[model samples]
Target: MVSSSSTPAAFVTGAANGIGEAVVARFLAGGYRVAMVDLDADRLRAAREKADPAGERTIEAVADVTDEQSVRAAISATVEAFGRLDAAHNNAGITSSGPNTHELELSAWQRTLDVDLTGVWLCMKHQLPVMLEQGSGAIVNTASIAGHIGYRNAAAYAAAKHGVVGLTKTAAIEYAPQGIRVNAVSPGPVQSDMLEASFERRGAAVRDWYYASSPTGRFASLEDIAHAVHWLASAEASFITGHCLSVDGGWIAQ
Candidate 1:
């Protein structure tokens, strides 16, 4: 179904904004059809308008990653539209609980895991089946530098991201023999509303901290992270699987 056209298609979650949005933009520019999914229906509409106003290549789907039924339907809808699924970016996630775990509520911890960790698994549960049927697919999950290191005051977020890394690796190994590739991109601080909101909640002016930690002396651009996901999902990184590619600005190097 995908080969019917000269271009391929991708199903991307968290695609209304931030890293997800950038990734969708990248794929669309490369002439790939995209199913841009997000929980916010209005934002999804906005993204579709901005990226594919004529509705020729990009379609919008509203779904919660935490809901299996919703995720399943979203993927199914993508296939119905694009004819086949060739790539997926399980990039839907959230962060909270601030920097102080002791101050973190049990509810917050559960919510974090339900979304940031379980959500990714829920997506792959449905997506992998489609890829298995097609006998070829590429998946790139969004991870974080926090997944590799213990970041203070973000116990729930860190734990969930660490789980994402583990899942990415395990899935990569399990699915590679099936003509599928699974990988992850771990990014450092990026200039996004999500990160800005985190700093706001802490009443923390963290520009200097992000700058100091990065030898590059700046936060990662969203485009940088998007490019990593694009390459890993494309034929360019055919041999790269079960790998956690870090898009951090030398944060993990320190």
Candidate 2:
């Protein structure tokens, strides 16, 4: 085991980069042993190394959230390493390409749901069991402002995120009596490679539109979203459950 039973341990998916990476840092900084999971094995190791150069407080789990067996094994591995699971951030997801509903292929829709919606469920399927066995745990899933509102060209992405919100609420209720709390963080435009790529593909006009829509007039940094995830999974938010906190820089308020 990596640490004493008194030390908290956390599992985070999509942890190789972006928001997930930042969340791992937050957890580690808070003195939690962390399992950094991602599909990209190399990046995951590098991330773990960067966050814990002494290799004392973190482990890297290469996992595909869409694969049940992979997710199960990763969770098991984390428990084996850390001795217990106290929190989980189911953050592995991908955004759909901007294709109108009429232009979107069926495969694209299925792919988005597989990674964004079904993936979250699979992680929780395995994670919840561990948390239940431990008698307490916190889970924070990554949602989006799009989950709360319809986006013009992202039908599948929006639908999948909407499903995430529903799942968060239902799971929170079902698991609350078991001493587990489930919630979600809905981020708007966050500064990351993914958003930058979208801007590259769509040009300045779309980017300007995003800026204008946000009351902050700017995108959120990865740390902004990470902070929300960390707080939602912490003891500070003990009374909050079945809630979807928006870290959107005031985008949805408009």
Top candidate (lDDT): 2
TM-score for candidate 1:
0.96
Instruction: Give TM-scores for every candidate, taking all chains together and pairing residue i with residue i.
Output: 0.96, 0.97
In the predicted model 2, the residue pairs found to clash are none
Worst 10 residues of 1 by lDDT: 1-10
**How close to the true structure is residue 96 of candidate 1, measured as C-alpha lDDT?**
62
**What's the lDDT for all of these models?**
0.90, 0.93
Clashing pairs in 1: 99-153, 100-153
lDDT, model 1: 0.90
For model 1, state the Cα shift of residue 130 in Å: 0.8
lDDT of 2: 0.93
- Residues 1-254 of candidate 2: C-alpha lDDT, one tens digit per residue: 33349999999999999999999999998889999999999999899889999999999999999999999999999999989999999999998867789999999999999999999999999999888887889999999998999888999999999999999999999999999999999999999998998889989999888888889878899899988988998999999999999999888887
Alpha carbon deviation, residue 182, candidate 1 (Å): 0.2
Query: Once all C-alphas are superposed, what RMSD does model 1 give against the true structure?
Result: 1.5
Report how far residue 176 has shifted in candidate 2, in Å.
0.5
